[model samples]
Target chain A: MKIALDAMGGDFAPQAAVAGAVLAAQQLAGKAQVVLIGTEEAVRPLLQEYGPAAATLELVPSTQVIEMGEHPAKAFQQKPDSSIAVGYRLLHSGTVEAFCSAGNTGAMLVGAMFTVKAVPGVLRPAIANFVPKLDGGMGIMLDVGANADCKPEMLEQFGELGSLYAQYVLGIARPKVGLMSLGEEEGKGSAVTQAAHQLLKVNPHVHFIGNLEGRDLFNDKADVIVCDGFTGNVILKMAESMYDIMVTRQLDDEFFARVNYETIGGSPILGINDNAIIGHGVSTPRAICNMLMQGYQMAYAGIVDQIKDSFKS
Target chain B: MKIALDAMGGDFAPQAAVAGAVLAAQQLAGKAQVVLIGTEEAVRPLLQEYGPAAATLELVPSTQVIEMGEHPAKAFQQKPDSSIAVGYRLLHSGTVEAFCSAGNTGAMLVGAMFTVKAVPGVLRPAIANFVPKLDGGMGIMLDVGANADCKPEMLEQFGELGSLYAQYVLGIARPKVGLMSLGEEEGKGSAVTQAAHQLLKVNPHVHFIGNLEGRDLFNDKADVIVCDGFTGNVILKMAESMYDIMVTRQLDDEFFARVNYETIGGSPILGINDNAIIGHGVSTPRAICNMLMQGYQMAYAGIVDQIKDSFKS
Candidate 1:
């Protein structure tokens, strides 16, 4: 299967992206084809630095690169020939089996959603990030800023999606799903969270584990933590900030730094029809490599298909 | 100045609270008096453990104690003579200079607000927690759950109150204030947070450091991290969960047995008319003592007066 890569994405675009592609190609040993999408002028030089893998890798030339700070939806529209837009189009047209990017997150989400569209019966695309907890198990946080406002039904769907993703991808059977709320009790949180909590608790498919307050999230009590995009994004940012602060304090600097940069290989964007993954824009070769592998595993598992099946009931 | 202590509050009640009061009295050296409020039968034995320091501490009898799982608002109505309710009333009636408890958080906040009332011009009372950061300085997060839906004006007020508390208590001048949002950009969060961002940017009295996402709360990027109670509580609980998860794994024992307990200190309830501090219910002797001392400092610093002045503008 051929995977489309956004070569011109992120602060260290082309160079880091291309290097990561080469590394992944080497690791996969051509079992999977890497198709780099970007302008040849910018990418060829970076590709040449790789020496051998550069020649073996395929290049699909695109003219523009979306800047990180640019308005995401508008940028994708204006820069139709940009790597993200082009790569997404390839995925849409079925030329590529999956797509990955370390570009503007907003742009990537917009490109993936508008171009590829959501799977049938799915409410909206959700971005799930792996948060490293001390339990040796990661907490899957969903809708980590895909859509800000979510209905109760949408939240239930997110819980189901998160549960399935955890079970199939993270290898947790009957993964316990908890709705993020203010308190773990029956009548905790705002109207939205409360309603969602009730829905998830009663849903037969999801291993609904009642409401989990922010404090309960890190416990091994729940494998999948579901919240609206706004709260999820806030939680994600909080975890990221803590890691940064802890590392900056020089507390086991290398350990936390590796945990911060290396452990979280990538955040898979679930709910879409195709295999679309978005890695940290500040992707090191290692993080990108992890994302590539994660994408491969996710594609093989047919998580999207499982998600579709989840909605069937 | 005299302080009323709810000895019957918290899981370790009477014992830890009595010990803390005795320690506080010794530390203060007759500067502040301690008035323990609880059932005489339950408190007398615990006070005996303090030896001579118990002589300086007096007891005011109360028949009931609010349980951890009890409904806070109704508990006061059902048992007005409950130690927490009575202690707050003592503070309200000017019979005591301050009241300290390690009781039901909701009950504490309710008693304090319904009895002592908010300092003049304060829209709402907020629960502020000091997050120990790598910078050696603590980041104070306010409105951790007191008021979920806050207006831009209220957030500005929260920022000012948080800043004032940080300045007087923590001794930071022009304390940096950050509005918590989904992202750090100028227009990145929900309407409330985004608008609060704009207002904070223009507010001159505040150090207004602009928008801070949840991740930045743990970092020393700012001294005061402000958010509505709903979001703030979520972040607080999430961080708390992180601490719990880490401690449990590090100790590898039963959850409660694994907790350091020593670090589970009290959270100061800001914006009340009087110096009233609330500790976590499961607090240890050290945390309760620290909070008692904190209550003394807050009372002596004329924190309410300073808060009164900051909001006058």
Candidate 2:
């Protein structure tokens, strides 16, 4: 399977993107292909050091580049040949099994919507991440800002997506899902949270664990946490900030030395047709490597296929 | 100053509650007068252990205890002489300068509102807690489930209360007040967060630091973080869950050693007319000691006076 790479994306542009892709392909051997997309001239120099491995790295020519600040929809329309747009187009047109980019998220989401389209029955395609928990397991939180203002129905869909992700990707059977709320009691949240709580209670597919308040996240009460994009995003971002702060403040030399970015890799973009994953913008080489490995693992896990089947069934 | 303690509150009612008060009075020395409000028989045995220090402790007669499942308003009304009710009455009738409880949060909030009353200009009092950043510093997020459904104007007041708390309690001069939202952009967040963001920007007394998302909590970008109780509570609880999970997973030894509740003490009731601090139900001896110390400091800080001044000025 080939992974469409957005060579013109991210702060480091073609250099970091191309270098990471070459390293990924080398590590994966001939089992996978890296189809680089962007201006040939810009990507060629970075490909030079790969030697024989460089031959396996394919390039798709594109003329335009989407500036980071460009309006998402406008940039996609105006720069259809941009690396990000072209990468998604390749996946949309079935040129590759998956697509990867460290591009503007708004543009990426917009592209995903206009190009690949949302999974059928899924109201919103959520961006989720794994948060390490006390039980030596990680919890999956969905709608972590994919759709900021979600309807009651949208939250219900997020529960399914979060549940399915944990079951397939995280390997949690009958993953317990919790609706994020202010209080644990029934009818104890805003209209949105309260209504969502009621829906989850009656929904048979979800292993609804009643209402979980803010402090309950750290507890092993639920395996898959669900909320509207706005609240979920806030929770995700806050947790990320706290983790970063803790690592910076407490973790010492060896903790991140061998396993930094270029090592652990990226987060899988769930609900997409392909295996596109996103990394932290500030991802190091080690983290990028890990992301590549993560992408490989996800593909092997058939997360996308599982999601497709779940959506269908 | 005397503090009315509700001994019949919390899951460990009258047992841990009585013990915590006895411990608090001993720890406070002669600095505070303690009034343990509960059935005299239930508290007397626990008070027996303190003996001399227990001399500073007195029993205020109360028969009924508000059960967690009982309706807060209805229960409080029916049991006017309940522990929580008596505690509030002591605070209101000027017999006690403050009241503290580890009871049902709904009951506490209701008791606070109808008993001690809201500070003069305060629209609503919020449940405020310190989020311990991995950095030695902390962030204060308010309205954490106090007023789940809030309007734009109430959020502005929350910002003010948060700022005042940071200034006097935390000692950050001209505390950078943040309005929590989906993102930091001026136009970001839901309708209420956005509107609150605009109002905070112009409020003279508040050092409005623009919008902050969840990830910003640990960045030290803002000294005082403000959001409606619903969102703030979700963020706080999620961050808390992350902290609990990370520490337990990575620092097992430290987790056990620092396993006591003193790591983060109880939350304080802000925007009230009296000095009231509500602790976590899972309070340990160390946690109770720390909470009592905090209650003392809050009294010393004249937080109630400052809140009153906010209204008068």
Candidate 1 wrongly placed segments (more than 4 Å) = A53-56, A133-135, A248-261, B245-264, B309-313
Q: Which 10-residue span in candidate 1 chain B carries the lowest summed lDDT?
A: B251-260
Local accuracy of candidate 2 as per-residue lDDT tens digits, A128-218: 7665554457677777777767788878877887887788777899999998887788878888878888888898778999888877665
Worst 10 residues of 2 chain B by lDDT: B252-261
lDDT of 1 by residue, B1-313 (tens): 8877889888888788888888777887768888889998998887787678678888999998888889989987888889988898888888988788888888988887788888888888888877765545677888888776678888988898899888898888779999877777887887777788888888887898888877676457899988888787888776766556545445232322212334535677888788888887787777777777787778887888898877674
Model 1 TM-score (B-chain only): 0.91
Fnat scores for every prediction: 0.76, 0.91
Q: Which number leads on TM-score?
A: 1
- Whole-model Cα lDDT of every candidate shown, in order: 0.80, 0.76
Query: Which digits, one per residue and each the tens of the lDDT, describe model 2 over residues B37-128?
Result: 99878888878976876778889989888887889889989988888888888888888877778777778888889878888888889999
Candidate 2 deviant stretches above 4 angstroms: A133-138, A167-173, A215-220, A250-275, A290-313, B12-15, B26-30, B133-138, B246-264
Q: TM-score for all predictions?
A: 0.92, 0.89
RMSD of 2: 3.5
